[model samples]
Target: MICKAKAQWIGYPPGSDTSKAWRTGDVVIGGAAPQNAKLTVTGNIVQTSNNNYFNTARLYMQSPGAIPANGQTYATFAGNTFWNNDSAKWQIANSDLTHFGMMRFSATGINFYTQTAATSAQWLTETDLASMLALTMQRGGNVGIGVPVSQAKLHVGGNGSPIDTIAQLSANMVIQASTGGRTTDRGAQLEFVLPSYSNGTNFWGQGRIITVAGDNIHGNAVGKMIIGTRRKFNKLGTGSDWYYGDDIVIDGKGNIGIGTLTPSKKFTMAYSGTQLNSTTPITSEMVVQASTATRSVDTGVALEFVLPANTDGTNLYGHARIFAQAANNTNGNAAGKLVLGTRRKYDKIGAGSLWYYGDDITIDETGNVGIGTLKPTGKLAVNGILLAKQVKVSQSAANWPDYVFTPGYQLPSLDSVAQYISENKHLPEMPDAKEVETNGQDVGKVQQLMLKKMEEMTLYMIDMQKRIDRLENENRELKAKSNNQH
Candidate 1:
């Protein structure tokens, strides 16, 4: 509801007389010049006859020889209907009308009816007539019937038409309508309507439309599709964000992401105790070798057949291949398992053709052991103890025998050696019989005395022999000296 007007009035086109017209009403008042335009009414100006023709009521024009300039023209009055019935009537043609018919106060309560007198009259608002004649006046506009209604809607036609309903406006227009007024049409209604497209021009409005058409439908819309330029995030809508394809989301920073950040997807290192990992593939011929430190499975650890218990039978068979190399530097370490296809008596057991060399024997931390086909060179040290086993010495290519006792062979038991001596009525084979003989008298006193005496006599005999040798050497030296003197 904004209206603007310049205060000062200016002259119109020259020679096009700026004179005004008159109006007919209760008490006709006129002006002083041709441009005089002031009309007022104190009573109703009504029809004196039942005549529907536009009535005419002549009001006196401006007085002659009066300069209409510098006159503040206006009209003011009020009254009820003034009528004239009978043949004798008073009618004046109201042409060259000017000035709005002003009514005021108690006399302004004027109504027009039943005119058998005044034939023609024109009652127009001041601005209303000014709008029709294109006059330079303030706040004047034409009047018309609004759509779907018959109320006189005043409008500045051709210049400023009256804007009443919301349907008459376009986009980006500001409209103020009555909040709850009941009219056939009130608020704005935006719709897309077009007939069949006959040309490229028909598809476009004021500019070219940039859109993505899929499945014969307008699906995605972009802002400006500049030709030959790469497509960016060139579209915007009601919201600040944009939607990508399904599941891919764009955030405020325009960074498109697929998955969450916390507790991210990653690979992990796994550990095992006595067995392989649960996710490891367990095969039929495969085995996992466990290690205490590092929790690793060495290739050396494997399965072997445990000897069955069935009395003292010497025949058994468990044949398999050894696949791992023996431990390096360390003397007794199990490389892998060994399989004996058959067994024999203890005496009959000899070296076989097959051999797996290491320190050639395996002794575990607990002194449990296995000797491969190749015999070890010296005594096997197991858990800080020396293991005594028979050694086979090759005399020739075809002559090799198992071990026989020597000077330092510790008997398995003293009773076993005693039994051997008692049964044979002789000592077991000894490499040093004199050394054993020297030990005969160490158990009892009689033997100890005899041993003492014998030891003394042996010592004396050794000293006597040494003296004899010395005398002979001395005599030889004397004989040589005598010969030299002779």
Candidate 2:
């Protein structure tokens, strides 16, 4: 156990005869010579000066001169005025010196345990040294000035039993586990029971003291907490897609946020204070949006919207939504094929002639085919249904054979006289290659009488003869007939 001395026998400059002091093979105070000394102890010593008065304080370790190579020094000291002058004191050689404590320059009387013979060395192992330190701290009791805990208790067994030993624990006492824990009838058990609260006032180790139900505080305060500068909240990497100071407020089931907290919401460019203000909503808005600038939408292939060269594995392989423009086989052997399947015999679009066993080429309702829009110019080559309308091969092949019209096809711009002349003029069998006959019928009245005689003449010869004679006489005879008939 530690031996404590206050040295309260005040004297002029604190003087006393060193001969009155105690000496041991392990410890030495002011020694047998006359010096300023009093109340010396050879064993573990706990000494404290009162009112900051200490003079000619000295301590020395007189271990053997020879120390083992690579040997360690174990020591501990702590005090406001603690100092040491051991810079040039250690002698290193081939002997062991372990477990030295308190080599401060200010504190005097180093306490130690050593071999009685000066030639022999005494050293404590780690466990022994630790035990001695515990014992010393336990015997020292409470210095009891400013330490948080003034006293502690060491219990061996049951509570409040007279047989159970209770030792007063010092304020600075650090009691270590003797052998870690204890073994009982119920295997190895570690039982820790906290001291009961002496008064109605609560203590932290038992019940809760002051709990922070909501926020403890807001804004920045010194030492209150600054989630260290090295620590980051949103750890978005060094890409351009990261945003900071954007807050996300979530409800019990929903979320109303300044910046979009949910993936289906929008984000606003505006910010309120350090927080982002909720204005616009972003459903599919991506921070790093990827799109196909060439086409209006993204096609999941590596190819651009327009390609310079066909990207076939070896030959010409088109990817998704593959399109061919003016693509044809040079030899016309139909070796050019668009594949849309794995390596197996399958239909691409369609095959030749009638009984083609292949996929059907479909025209969508919007008139688009394959993967894009289809626009026909001049004529559209259709493979599906065709609606038909009647067309005349020759307009001169009339309502009846006797009703011969001159110009084969009637033009839309033909006037009344022109239409009559065209209808009455005897058209040549090949009007396309021959001149049309426009003579002898009254061109003006021909529009009226043309239909009347068109039904009257049943014989082809009579019709031809009458028209030819009328043409031979020209309009001079035609006008007389018109007037007489009228």
Candidate 3:
């Protein structure tokens, strides 16, 4: 029951102001058909609109009932309410009559609908409706850019995405000091600044992760990253006066250093003690440990030291390694060993990842040390012949050969020793030739046997001297008696 209001002006009287020229019709506020616009009478205003450029509807809600959640606390909160009209679109205009925002989706004017996803898993990396987000800005709470809910102070979520274009893929944050010159601060940084307790105006940085350009050579410029953690210091005039001792620096050469400005190697750590003495403990500590009680080859820890090799621009040749691994790979039984390895002679890091090495030394679980071997049988085992300047063998007083001179000790007669040697072809209480060939002789016990034999030989020599003296005296007396008789 709606129609376009077309009342013809009959005529103005000569002296009167105006006159009403109304035919049989109901007053329509919009164009021809208002039902197609989905017009409804909500309040005092006769809201009428049709799909046309000029026809429009405006709702002015000035009471508390208009808000979606009148008691919209955090606990029992219903979300946003959309004021949707089924006509062409919505265009909220100022007094100047310009559209405030753009409309997306199937709508034409300003709409509350959007296409941006709230998570990085959706791969919605594009920036449509990025500026004006339909966010609840009622309280200054945690904000999440691409997450379902804010779990942190600032939660930025996005993972590996295809980066085919410059601004198309990947969720990234850029902090730029674009207007400044290429000084020490080439780019911007994220700093943890703490307010000073002295006054609210003063602030100091507890830590900062900053980026800098190595040079201003445009195309050939290198970049370095610096992560600084300030040490505890007394409050001074300004932050420039504070001393920060620890900084992790990653240079353009891909070298990293902790507590050192210059990193000469791939990774370096430094600790500068004020004054070091004999009692100073080993510093610049690094520990590699297995997380669980189970120990195996897969769960072992190793520190490899390697140098770059002459290969296809990217190869490292292992020089040496210090590792701790399971001594035996048995399932139920477990033991640990510390192994040191040197690079095998044939490997040059040519093609395959060569992890095999020569086990130069090992300290096993039974306190046995092996050199040039893995399994040591004794307290100290060496696969090769050991070369040394001198060797000292120590024994208890009970083992010393001075017992040969004791009163109760019996010395073997020479005739008996000769008889035994003729029968056995070896000394008594000594190993045979076959035994010596199979199992090596103990140097300490052999030395003791040699000393005992030498002492027995000395005693035999002394007894023979006494016998010669008696025979010489008897011969001299007989010669004197024969001469006197003549």
The top-ranked prediction according to lDDT is 3
Q: Assess candidate 3 and give its lDDT.
A: 0.60
Candidate 3 Cα outliers beyond 4 Å, as residue runs: 1-301, 308-315, 329-334, 345-356, 406-408, 478-486
Report the C-alpha lDDT of model 3 over 213-233, residue by residue, as the tens digit.
Answer: 756765544667888767655
Every candidate's lDDT: 0.33, 0.31, 0.60
TM-score attained by model 3? 0.47
TM-score of 1: 0.14
**What's model 2's lDDT at 344?**
18
Best by TM-score: 3
Better of 2 and 3 by lDDT: 3
For each candidate, C-alpha RMSD in Å?
36.0, 24.7, 14.2
- Compose the digit string of candidate 2's lDDT tens values, residues 154-264: 312112334433444332323333423331111211223344467744422321111011222343111110111111235342445322322333322333444432323
- Cα distance off (Å), candidate 2, residue 310: 36
Q: Model 2 reaches what TM-score against the true structure?
A: 0.19
TM-score of each: 0.14, 0.19, 0.47
Give the poorly placed runs of model 1, Cα more than 4 Å off.
Answer: 1-365, 368-469, 473-486
Better of 1 and 3 by TM-score: 3
Poorest 10 consecutive residues by lDDT, candidate 2? 222-231
